[model samples]
Target: MLLGLAGNSCIGHILRCFRAKTHSSFTSPINSFQFSRSIYCATMASAAAGETRTEPVYFSDTYLFSFDKASVLKAEKLEGDSNDYAVVTDQTIMHPQGGGQPSDQGEITTSVDGTDVVFQVKQVSKAKDSQEIKHIGCFSSGSAELLPVGQTVKMTINEDMRRLHARLHSAGHLLDTALNRLNASDLIPSKGYHFADGPYVEYIGNVANEERDKLMASMNEVLSDLVKENIATQITVGDSGERIVSIAGLPCPCGGTHVKSTAEIGPMKVTRMKKNKKNMKMSYSLESS
Candidate 1:
């Protein structure tokens, strides 16, 4: 079954950000692609020698970096189900859905001796370890090419998809900040919260209907100001340590990419509000001009 975004509200925003970019902009990197291929080969050889390292898992970390296109080492497809899959590259620019975020969508292309052979990518997932990662793509019916183990391949993510998911994920952070501030100023204690996909965000606690309205209005007002979204230095802490990134007046620990400014979010509208158990649910959507 296709994973639903119902209870997983926080990831909804990420899906939106990544779903908006154009894939064509990610042509093979400009410098000699062969150099990247050599690096990929070398990396694979090292891994074969039993050197183990943590693969950087977020696409945002490497999306903007230009490297020899061949740096990505292809791995064998260890396992897969119908919808989810696992694939390992010498390195990757795809972010899996973990830590309350969604995964990415893109294609992996393999060339045989400088000639394009096959291209396909339906969905991506991470394996339990870096060594046995697999990428699952939906191939056209009766397609002949099968991605054999050790085949030299070039992988590219749908750039627009990454951008959209990033935007929504960042916006969700802003929403959390808004809720925290409103609750604090009003003397309401927040009990729980989640930012549903698209614009539906909810915070659970002892907040009155009037307070919810006020909070929404205040957030909209802040959005109107179009504050800039800055990349604060990433501070990684122990699992129990406090992590914080402030956008507008909100601060929290966030390990996701965001737009440079809030104004880029365009206009936001709160469409629905309700209560679930002791928690409140607020649904919203972005207004496109």
Candidate 2:
């Protein structure tokens, strides 16, 4: 759903900073595009060659912004692009776009002819039915150096952008918490669009039109109080290898990165609410800190 932020001029620059200029056919969330068949095959073949799956360091340590030695496994120029490339590495701290959160963007630096070169990581994604994560972008040296297989590279994500995304994601969950706390058991959360422009959570149920105003105000107040409490964010893995996240001591399965605590989510508000017969959308935004 498109958000109408007509009067919020300040939010315009923030949205621009996070917006990705992509050339894919369908473009909403930048990193969820489909890779070509050949690109997909190459990635799966590399995985079947007995190398281990890409190590997702972000799953273990969300605060780790840089890693010194990530071995490049496969790098190829994406189809229909002159200089754009798709890179697969032995491991990544860059979280691929999934689970309602946006992909992390930064640079992958490696030495070329005794000088440093960089691959600008604009989009990171998993192939439609594969577990392989592809880092898609162009190189600072153009196509002169598509990182060679087995080349060691240094990876760094934009720390500010990462923090903003994490906070926005956690704030969405926090809004869910507020709903439950306020005893709105009827609204069942089913989808979350945590993109920076207008992050919102969609639910499977509806609220009465007459009560929307009062309920929204209550949600905002509860969210504010919860943030002030400085509730720590907790992540635990279940026996089946599922990651469970908890804020305000209520747990839910999640795979996205998050802030260290709810306090990091400064202020949140349920800015707008829309409901049809069978579903509802609760639009929310974090107050600029």
Q: Which candidate leads the pack in lDDT?
A: 2
What lDDT is obtained when candidate 2 is compared to the true structure?
A: 0.69
lDDT of each: 0.44, 0.69
Q: Could you tell me the TM-score of candidate 1?
A: 0.60
Worst 10 residues of 2 by lDDT: 1-10
- Candidate 1, superposed: residue stretches over 4 Å from native: 1-54, 57-86, 127-134, 139-152, 180-197, 226-245
TM-score quality measure for candidate 2:
0.80
Which whole-number lDDT from 0 to 100 does residue 57 have in model 1?
Answer: 36
Models 1 onward score TM values of: 0.60, 0.80
Clashing pairs in 2: none
What lDDT does candidate 2 reach at residue 255? 61
